[model samples]
Target: MKIRPKVTARALAVLGLGALVLSQAACASPTEPGAATTASAAGGFDYTDARGDTVTLDTVPHNIVMSEQAAAALIPYGIRPVGIWGSSTPDMSGVLAGLDVSGIESLGVSYGDVDVDKLASLEPDLVITGWYAGGYLGGLGAEDAEVSKQIEQVAPLITVSAQKSASASLDDWRGLAQTLGADVDSGTIADEKSTYDDAVSQLKSALAARPGTTAYAVAPSTQFYVAIPGEFAELIDYAEWGLDVRESPIARDSTSGSFSPVSWENAGDYTSDLLLYDTRAWTTPLAQVERDHPTVATLNAVARGHVVDWTTDATFNYASYTKQIALLTDAVKALPASE
Candidate 1:
């Protein structure tokens, strides 16, 4: 039977391994603090983020606000922001579930639904969001110009790139953590880096033994949107790490978010050795996604039961991806050897 991802206590308990990796990160060896944490004549802290915009802070900017994705990265490093905005209502199934977020203010449930008044009242010094193209692209940042203006006025908004390779994003998060005064070399942050490296190594070893295995990523909803894996940070990292992530049958021109919408009848048009289905909400069972269009079963991966849960919609952070990659490695190990 195909398993559906549910937001239940049991599901979280199964996801606890990732949380364990994060909870143990705080004890790694410490490194020297970055200049951002020390006093400078500039009278504040400054950083050039993924968008290449310079965000300056009057002081160490203690009260922080961010999109839930950014919070996922910062929280494990002990840099808890004061407020968070999620794509949906806060739940225990999210990347931030392992940590206590009760004290963190919730801006709104979905993107474009942020409470500008409540956000401003938080009196935040810095706001972190996801970078798509050249601007903020997640949560409140995804709102209209007026909404963005309202939030920007309250605090400077910095973003990490959501379109870069996962490895790049991981490096950016490490830099961001240090800039935010986190001891990146010590604690859970450092431990996560080590775990991530080991996971990647394991993935590489598995792939090396089966170099021809191909994988395709898809987000299945009422429609099937087959992802061009290279376009996503995580998928790109997987490809570069030696997985045969294939390109899309049809190319789309959108930046950052791009996918080819396929009818169920043609779902098997793009098939591979493995099928990585999106794990976000709205994703139905593998059978249901191909209900009317039985042609999906013709896909090699599907016929061979090679489907795996892909966390493309979840937050991109070392702590999150470390666990994700480890799971992928395990999945690969479980696959039968090619003839």
Candidate 2:
């Protein structure tokens, strides 16, 4: 066989060029051996937040913000965040005490008041914010241009939304944890997840001990609201967490409010085994709920002392969906066992 030096040289040159291209691509891609990727990408973390927004973060975040669904997701990490979002009352205060964030509460911020300054000051490389950004984000330009820029500057943000429908946020909390924690909190994150998993397992056993019982939760803000588990309803999957969480016609009006608003006139129509209240508001005024559509007696939960002060234990964005399952589990257990 005759050897051709010219042809051999061309082949070697082409091979060299291919190597350069591959190296360049590796540099350009977000998914590096130690770097994070998207949900669809290998070692990816594709997540949808409360705002119906989809976002991807490489390798999990270490200094997570413990955004909207803190207890639902981050508390399990045992990271004891420097900051978190909360409601305007004791529910949040009490819930915080149970987790590692006890000292950082003031470091705590609210949904609409995310302390963009605080977040920026922390200068954290990564954050675990929610999809809603608690309305802190989006709808920029004109009036909100300044705050909008401020948020983008608060470090790269990842959005998370939990919903009842397929279009709702993805149940990627564990995946997100696994992804973000891979950086530094891997072992701690795993332990945190195990703790959460164990808590859930215990909750299941507790639930299994009893026969099925219908349950419902209400958050009394300025008005009355209900918490319904959608696609991200981890509580709905509990071992003993029973419920008939059907979407009410009122919910058809997304504008009215979520979890369903209870007017005094219509409170009787929605009674079940129990009714949970945000109580953070009522805790002070101590005013009895005036669900006047029917006398309070008309509602079975009210009749059975099932009406409860539900502040701690639930977790949602801004307590938005704080629908804290562990809190709910404990609360439901506190209920009088129905014979």
Candidate 3:
């Protein structure tokens, strides 16, 4: 499951404090072998996941079960899982776009809906998913402790954190994919990395040219949800790349402390030269949003047509990020400098 960066009240309430404490205390050192270890080692598969847990196996896992988001990251490197589960159908998942998943078994499509029996039937050697803040597992609800326990019983469960910056998360995936026996340094992977680097350079140049073009990333629902740039991997990358992405004061006062949800009537309170509008499936479409929340139309960014579609669920991979960065660069080029 691809988890959103935005933390809702319900999500906050379910966070496992004990898990969070364990994760902090057991945080592995940066130079740990498991972080950069390869599966080719004579001792067999040994890798440390985001939670800092070192999962050691007698042999490299050939049959794996992964969250669709994880599959998206690994598939590009030629690491295919035996089974996958997601928060949406494969066709509907933005992260799973342009990938071939015909041969993989579908464990489930909705959050917390994993078919444990089917997953076990596949005889998966490893179950890989994303680890999120609050100790939440991707595709599994925070409250679904029983399901998590059951999945753990079937196979060793591991994760890469979704809480890291896009680049950091991608690096983690690269290491994990290498541990899973992917040739990450050659052929298609190398070419993709070069392309991604070029895209990053282009985006930086674009932002440099468009000095002072402030942006506000947001999702429209019954409320106008302002994204906290620090909480989102892609948004953090954009900010670091020199875009003046605005921060929401509401996040400071929010119970979830991840995003600020303003009433539609107060949507005009936050404004920027450019608007990074969330276009995830869960958000209300921009056109419908404008019609329903007329106040949103009053924002200067909206009036000037300076809105850019932001894919919140983009995969943590060079290929996916190369496209995202290109789109943002184009948007930056089109945006006018702030007054």
User: In terms of TM-score, which candidate is strongest?
Assistant: 3
Task: Give a tens-digit lDDT track for model 3, residues 18-80.
Answer: 121111112223444227544344746767777666666657778888999899999999888
Error of 3 at 19 (Å): 26
Off by over 4 Å in 3: 1-34, 38-43, 251-257, 337-339
Top lDDT hit: 3
Q: Candidate 1 residues 33-56, lDDT tens each? A: 111223243445556555555555
Segments of candidate 2 deviating more than 4 angstroms:
1-72, 75-95, 102-108, 132-148, 164-171, 182-212, 220-242, 251-255, 282-287, 290-294, 307-339
What is the Å distance of residue 124 in model 1 from its true position? Answer: 0.4
Arranged by lDDT with the best first, the candidates are 3, 1, 2
Output the lDDT of residue 15, model 1.
Answer: 32
User: Lowest lDDT 10-mer window, candidate 2?
Assistant: 1-10
lDDT of 1: 0.68
Candidate 2 scores a C-alpha RMSD against the true structure in Å of 12.1
